[model samples]
Target: MKRSHSNTGANPDVRVRMRRLRWTTFSLVAASYMLAFFHRMAPAAIASDLQLAFDASATALGALAATYFYVYTLMQIPTGILADTLGPRRIVTLGGAIAGVGSLLFGYAVTMTEASIGRMLIGLGVSVAFIALLKINAAWFHDRHFGTMVGLTLVLGNIGSVMAAAPLAWVLQFTTWNTVFIVLGGVSFALAVLTWLFVRDHPGEAGLPSLREMDGHEAHPPHEGHWFEGLMTVLRNRYTWPIFWMNLGIGGSFIAFAGLWAVPYLSDVYGMERVAATQHTSLMLAGFAIGAFSVGVLSDRLGRRRPALISTAFVHLLCWLPLVFALPMSLAMSYSLFLLMGLSAGSFTLSWACVKEVNPHALSGMATSVVNTGVFLGTGILQPLVGWTLDRAGTAQGAAAQYRLGILIFFFCVVVGFVGSLRVRETYCRYIS
Candidate 1:
């Protein structure tokens, strides 16, 4: 990988210079990831409009929403390889361009088939962003701070999710959803150009001293393992499987409920207006954003993953119990529980850090991507499955019953995640440093 040099002169205050570089890098990477989140999730924000426009059923809507994940799941390994080999800078630049084009296509799409194609393109384009950002974090930050940094990045990037909720709804009131995507697509293209021009692969390549070097620590070389060998290593590890399954369950359930159905579920079942439902959904994302940052900081501060993971899972399990009963509850109560769900569910963002810690340094990309695969794959399958169950149930009231069943299923998934979390060897006590 090649690096850029802003200046070659020896600095009087090397620490200050390094700090500035780190922040700049963090900001750029976070922005790119935010755009990826925007593209990945924008569909859900406008699901109601899509169903009306296309005159599609709930199952069809779910399938369309899951289209992004379908391609994202398939690209995980390839993205991992690209992140490792080409480095995050170039891969993310390319990804942004692809995503930008896809968004434009989606904006222009008039039919469900066209929309599906656009969604797939958007998925393929943005699929590399998260893993690539993780690769950059591993390159730039100290190992001890890795989990917290990843969590912080997720916190900032998920502002896209927040925007995808009420803000998007507000935007739609002024213009069509298609126009919003068109504008977003153009912004994505510009960001890609900036990434290509400004982002460097690593500190050493940029002719600046690496933090490890500055701190009198040795930097590890890239692992020499082949892709298949790296894959096998990740698969064979007992610790890795637990995190993988944990992500599959926790992330899957979170994405299914919060990302895909929360708004529609509120509107259709709770009898809230679309705008109110979108706002409530935004509140859920706001809770997630806060939780993601908090969990990361606390995990780093406490140096423990299991307690955070287990506690959050338990909270998430409790949140679902109320929804499953579906007794006559105030809208305020439902929103509060949903916020709790988001906060509890956000703990899974720690899974990326966990995956990075358990795998060898050489295979961090592969390990992270593999664990993430379970997340997207599970969402892709479950979103439509939930919708299908509701469709089969017939009436709106019946659909609410079906959704309750889905929540119960999600509760079971949280249990699965809790068990998987326990299976993993606790890494927080043994700092990556």
Candidate 2:
């Protein structure tokens, strides 16, 4: 296959500049990913405001937050397809525009139905971003860097989650959630424009050779085949299932906690004020952001996937024991547990690189999406189950006593995920054994 050279015929200066361009493109895509996280976790910050605004019960409130996950879960496979076929530039641009509209609708809506619609739209749009961003990472950077880049992308994305925490509560003190989202909407639109102008699906499109080519692989980009064929190949793989379930567990629990329930859990169980509760929640997310970056780089350096996956998950399962039993602790201990849990949860990012490496090179986007579906699916299932369990006890705000059964169920999910992580065949960061 022929190589892609810089637009200036591989001028030394232009070639050097191209490296800078790659990071620039990554930042733009990461910004969109950040917005998605903001939307995912924003409901936690404003859960009370939503209750007062719509008179929504806990189940209803859980569903409202979960509305994003519902659409996002369903979008994963198709998102992979779009990322592969339409390319990251188009999909992210389109996703950004759609998400912008969704933000506007969400911010201004009064009724629960309207709010739900906005949430769904936001989910629908933002769902396209992460998968596409992964595709960009695969195409732009070397294979060895995938784990670190994935982790770093997640780090930036969690900045959005961080913002949705105490920072959002502080923002709401001065302005309505309505204003907050409307401004977010405008920012999304602006990002869409920047992504369109800058992002290239692969280096070849930007007048540069593929990273693999530059690294001496001399390989052509993998061709997309029949969707059914690709899907079945991935589905039939022994490795995919374990990682999928593992993600459903760790990723799901993280979303369930940080995305919606953690703040309220603190409030009801510990009597924390809203700002204080969200600040605690913020610590958990900060830990996740840091862990995602740190462990990803660590995994790459060690060149081992399964050990990292299993160890982090085991630690996560043990952390849940306290929460599952509602173990009493000092305030500092509680904050520390949340931080540790966040770190454990963030390790699931390894599953992304694992899934990609085990699948066909061309199918990386699709494979990544398949595993990612579990993250949202888990959240979609667990969040509502917690709400429903709370309702059964006639407790909408989820009093500590009412959360016993739900906590058990959450523990069960974690157990299953941990076991699955143990079952994952080591890829050792390559496509073939």
Candidate 3:
């Protein structure tokens, strides 16, 4: 069993400085991550706007939205390596700058091709945020504090998701989608500058004792300083693949729905106005945001990962039943289910802590990124596939039913993921390292 590290070794003044540095660095990186989250899901709110803007079909809209995931999926492993070696300071700052430029291009895109290019850039830029922020959390906080912080990071990032929902719906009433994206791009650029100026990857760099040097430090990597060695080590772990598949199913399904299809599904199937549907989507995301924190804190307190994760998966799986069967329900009932699904969906974050605990401590970024690749891969493929399904379903009257069918397929994928997750070895809050 691994021991917990003390984070109180530094004197009061130095400790205060370290705490400030930890939050400030985390805040900057998290801000960029928030933007990334925003861009990833923004398409959902503006599906109609985008469709009208380019006269795009459902498939085309999906392709445009999915371009982000395409680049993002391709970049995960490399970004993980970059985060591990090049460090979060550089990776996140560069990512924010690129994301900003992508946002600008996406905003100004008048043609479908141009919009695809912009989405590609946005994907490329923001792909770094998730892995990099995980690396940052690994560096600054105590192991016991790790899951909590990661959950909090998700909470922060999901704020962008929240913004992308009801708020974005509101904003669209007064402003063109292009203007909103352009302003977000500018914000991403500013976050980059702040990140560069204030963030450091390690406490030692800020003149504080490294967490390993603190009292009760228990885990130690068998190896370090070899770049590919760390990545290969993570890749070879038996438990890694199931978690990967789990991510593919869970995160992928969530991305497929919440990122693109959920709003349209609601509006089409239930005849919801855009605002009402967006509010439902927003509640779902809000539930996701809150659930991330609750589950993390609970997982930490109980010092158990697998049971909590499995339980969440089960609940999440159940949430899909209503959508899968297209069970008739009131708006209130639909909203309740969406919120429940969001909360259950957040169990995905626990996988990160699980992977982090089981792998070599030095390879946190590599492990996370490798697992993360599955997430984007799932999204990249499913978004377009669902769109294709919608387009090929035939006849205008049948389109709504077809969209519902796409969602049902996504539900089955989620089941596969949760079952696969059951096969992963439990870490119980202790690193094998």
Candidate 4:
């Protein structure tokens, strides 16, 4: 009887310790994810600065920024595979360190070629973050709460996007953009250290029960097949391809704009100051973060996926129409429109959840990574395409007219994403097969 009582008392302490450890691990990983967002979107806020520093044209600038997405696009599947095999802690730690070194190289780059190489390294390193975070979420959180956790993860990570926008513009007023990347490099190294010291791949690594086991349920079975076979399985699954296309359309266009083109669009077309332009991107990113959180919670609560995804996607489609048409707008109206566009675009976050629910549970990383590759692939294509279009448009057209073609390209992609949302298999927020 005494022994039984002692065991019961010890269990509570263990549970508390487990909870603390998981959150510690999550916080560190999330911090690294924030750096990824910062690196991605920072190029836009400092576009003119880059031009002045490098003596680059619009096409060259686009290529420099797109370099990150190109490498990131290629790395997604491999990162996913590593996340599954190596576990999140080791990969995230290594990723953060490499990203730190990349940032330092970028900060000190003397030419566009050097900067591109640094940017490529940064992309290669940070590409592991989101997939690894998803893997960590799967291990640490309840299945039912996966959507909310993903939403929360995106919300937190988008804070870095927000920082890269108006706040980055503001900081540039006092310091050079080079200084910012250098400081961020130091921060990445610090996070790498923290992650290695505290993060465990799952509760088991910390000597605690799996979440399922703690709930008196069976734990998810480990993947018995080879990792390559498991990846091929995810690729062969018909349900997986739709979300990949959906991400390509929505996630790709959104990042292309916010990451490199939005500030320039506003500045070139509307005569807005850099600070004012960044303000629009900042609000847009904030809306995106909020939208991500809301979509996740609402989808999980309703036990449905298609309705929210379809509705939000339709809204996103409509938001693109105004920009593509170059409609007249006051400052207040412009802000509202950009915010609405971002809020609607937030629906894209559901693609990850949707893809994960349809594929084998053990291959969650690979499955989600496959779709995520679509996002960067789209960005890689569109960023340079927009710049090429803008350069082709030439100064012969007025600045306002110059951007219409680029915005039209964005609108066309969003339409494709909206269509893709219609075909996503409804998993009812669970594994269907």
Whole-model lDDT per candidate: 0.80, 0.87, 0.86, 0.91
Give RMSD to native, each candidate.
3.2, 2.2, 2.7, 2.4
| Per-residue lDDT value at 124 in model 2 | 93
Worst lDDT run of 10 residues, candidate 3, spans 1-10
Where in model 2 is the C-alpha error above 4 Å?
1-11, 395-398
Q: Write candidate 2's Cα lDDT for 5-46 as tens digits.
A: 333444576558668878888889999999999999999999
TM-score of structure candidate 4: 0.97
Return the top candidate by TM-score. Answer: 4
How many residue pairs clash in model 2?
3
Candidate topping lDDT: 4
* Candidate 1 Cα lDDT to native: 0.80
lDDT of 1 by residue, 1-433 (tens): 3222333223546657666666776677678788777765666678878998889898999899899999999999889878877888888889889888888988999999988998888899889888988887887888878877888888887798888878888888889998988897898899899888777767766666665655555556667867788778888887888888888888887877777787777776788887888777777778888888788888888988878877887787777777677766797887787788788887788888888888887678888999999888888988888888778777746646767766677778777877787776678733352
lDDT of 4 by residue, 1-433 (tens): 1123334335888779878998998999999999999999999999998999999999999999999999999999998999999999999999999999999999999999999999998998899999999999989988898889989999999999999999998888899988888998899899899999999998878777777777666677888999999999999999999899899999999999999999999888878999999999999999999999999999999999998899998998899887877777899999999899888888999998899999888899999999999999999999999999999999998888999889999888988888889999999988885
**TM-score comparison, 3 vs 4, better candidate:** 4
Report RMSD for candidate 2.
Answer: 2.2
Better of 3 and 4 by lDDT: 4
Error of 3 at 238 (Å): 0.5
lDDT (tens digit, per residue) of candidate 3 on 49-140? 99999999999999899999999999999998998788999988888899889889989999999889988988998999999999999888
Shift in Å, residue 91, candidate 2: 0.7
Q: What are the models' TM-scores?
A: 0.94, 0.96, 0.96, 0.97
